[model samples]
Target: MPPTKLAFFRYLLIDEMLRSRSRPFPTKEEILEACNEKFGVNSISTIEKDMAAMRLDFDAPIYYDKRQKGYAYQDPEYKFLSVNLSEDEMLALSFVETLLGEFRNMPIFSLFSVAVDKVLDGLELTKKLHTEKRHLQQAIQIEQAPYLKGSDKLGDLLRYIAEQKVIEVSYQKYGSESTKDYLVHPYLLKEFRNMWYLIGYHEASGEVRTFGIDRITQVLPQEKDFLPQEKVNFDAESFYFYCIGVTALSEKPAEIRLRFEPFLANYVKAQPLHHTQEIIEDDEQKGCLLRLRLIINHELKMLILGYGAGVCVEAPASLAAEIRREFEKGVAQYATKN
Candidate 1:
């Protein structure tokens, strides 16, 4: 029979006792007393049966030492949960732990460190070996924005999301001197370009709105309960389906076609701008034509602008004109004085 939750916990306790360096081997009576204290009272016969199960089922190298007058592992290094990881896999795990360093300053993901440490401990990676593997962090650095604002609000917002609470927020938009109050039923917390945003149902507007976390001055106490999920009807996937970045300004998505220079086309093919992105045409002389169905927002515009002269918007004459105007403005700026 498979072990019950209580049975598994008893097995763990027994394993710890067997592996104890200072106490060494422990008597059946001692093991029973410890298990009984934690779980319900278990008899000495139960301990014997548990050890037998450990030996048979788990292949635990458990034996009774006559000299010590107690039960012990024949293999001192034996663990109930043995995790065998390849050297490469171990290094990858270490690299993942290092990647989490991006959120080290954020309190919301603090448990991630503890969880990774537990896995490393289970793998029995020596301190020196683990430290050496961590050198990969220095070799492959993850770029993180220094001193991100509103990071401290992550923990509280996460808690509110879990509890399904409605919150009142004091917000000030960029370049706006005035601060406004909002009653929001926060649904999802999204991150884009190292900045955080709260996607929620705005009670006053009776529609969904996106609020930048950095712009939020305060989250007031819960004056009202959250609206029913059915009433809110917020589907994060559907909401973001046609959207690029945080803003979903339009109800319908535009079919955007773009042409990239040959060299830049290779990079775009490898790392696509959107999930709906498709290579419509590619040629040695003509370059590449890419198609994307997306809502043309500030982020998409900025991304296209970042590519400079390498990319050209082919379809959507309005968007193409907008890009042309932007480029013309840039050229005009350069034509004049600095």
Candidate 2:
């Protein structure tokens, strides 16, 4: 069958079951299998999405009948709305669902994918949206996407934050490999480069600190009272706003200059390393000069070094000199090895 005809046929599966002529109220799995057998839309998850869209967008009166052990219309008289779309609209909808699926992989926005599925289902478009999206995903490439770890701790931590409770956590810092316990006044959760981090006030340290969720081994909610005012106040809008990765820089942002080789200049312009980046000068012969207002931190140094010889720190002679010294030490080790 052609795309439009295939879409209409899928609608018949759910609509036929909803009408009083109902032989048996079809379970989601039944509808899902029927569509899958006829059309190639697999996955029970997709069926839930379709139902969500059906209710939210088209006001399709669908409800589950416990006695029948399957779905039924709350109002038996209701009919599925006819939604027609041009080819462009179909592709756009598919792209949106694909993008949402990407965001949903992140611990923070994980539920967003379901919302996208509902949007597609409500439009009454069938598997064609996913068919287009799948093709697009295969053709495109996403480079060096950071992998997230420590999803196990996310659920417990979220509950602790919502309950306004202090928790005793056993955390193992990166590279330490040994877990240490601390009384934490949990404030917020942050995602940096796809990794999850917990921001809280360490009761023993009397200072705010961030902990990687992956590093946490245990979190036990404590009845020990805590006040909201006591929560870590970094004063910045976002915990990681000033710094890259999960760490925050306490020092004020500075005016720093950098010069990138001509070959890398255009790429840097298109994908800025930081939000404060500004073009100080760009000339074919002179190379690309850029300025940024940011704190100088360990992470900042690492980011600069990532470009290797393609980039150089220009101003704040101190920072430039530090880079030189590190390179000299690194070179000595390699030279000795040779």
Candidate 3:
């Protein structure tokens, strides 16, 4: 009457078949004995029904063999079901995987490894053709820039954060002579430009701060724990929606407008800056205009500068002023030198 017992028998039988590929065909009695031995289920009728369901609908062929007088693989060359990703999807996944590796001390690496293995297994079983050699070579040649060290401690901090445990971290603040030890309740781990950051609440200050993992000289699990006072309402995706970088936001999210050179404009259109970005106007003869709604962050500033002369930030008085200040400072430095 119970369906779980039947399903269990079916799974056992199919697994045996897959594992015993080189062995002679297994008979009904052999399957029944194996199922009973493995799962303690003696229901033969349930096994029959399970096999029928698997063979009919699940594409698992459980045909009888004449030579060995038992069941064997009907199609040994069957393929596994796998999600076929496009070039862009593959690129995005590869990028994220590489970036996430900065946290080598994290327990997340094992989980990520399992998922990646499953995906690779499915693709390996089903893939009809290998990646083109020329394309693969080109992709390999496309090198990502080198990154800073200290991934082991980063990983440990991330694991501790995921467990919601308090961690004592010895951190060296930038431009500071001394290092400080603090009990931190880590909330999130974010990656930008192959660097790792832990967003957490400090015990002493009771304020949420983002700490660079590189600057965190040491991290260890603390017996003392603290709950988030304000529930840490920040969503990384929503919080980082506006700004070009990982800079914090004081104001509400805003819509930012930018003009890109025709060459870079089309590229920007194809590969959007953010999920909320859109092309407000397109005049190829002049240039293309893009509008993005996101939190203004330090990461965004670096990204804007990355485009060099190909793109210009056109709106938001605060952002424009910041850009002007940076450029004017550079100009002043050169002028004073002359």
| CA lDDT of every candidate | 0.86, 0.78, 0.69
Supply the TM-score for candidate 1.
Answer: 0.87
- Each candidate structure's count of clashing pairs: 0, 1, 17
Model 3, range 1-338, lDDT digits (tens) per residue? 46676575557565566548576676677777777776666878856776787667557666776777977657765432335578676655555544444433445465675575466566552132224333443455433535455566656776776687888888898898899998888877777776778887786885777788888888878887457535756565555555554566676777788899999988888998888888888987767998888777776777787787788889887887887787778789989884
- Between candidates 1 and 3, the TM-score winner: 1
lDDT tens digits, residues 137-180, model 2?
87665654454667756878888888879999998877786889
Please list the residue runs of candidate 1 whose C-alpha ends up more than 4 Å from where it truly belongs after superposition.
1-3, 16-26, 37-42, 65-69, 72-78, 126-129, 220-223
- Candidate 2 wrongly placed segments (more than 4 Å): 1-92, 99-111, 144-147, 175-177, 224-226, 229-232, 235-238
TM-score of 2: 0.69
Clashing pairs in 1: none
Question: In model 3, what is the error at residue 112, expressed in angstroms?
Answer: 5.2
Give the Cα error of residue 304 in candidate 2, in Å: 0.7
Between candidates 1 and 2, the lDDT winner? 1
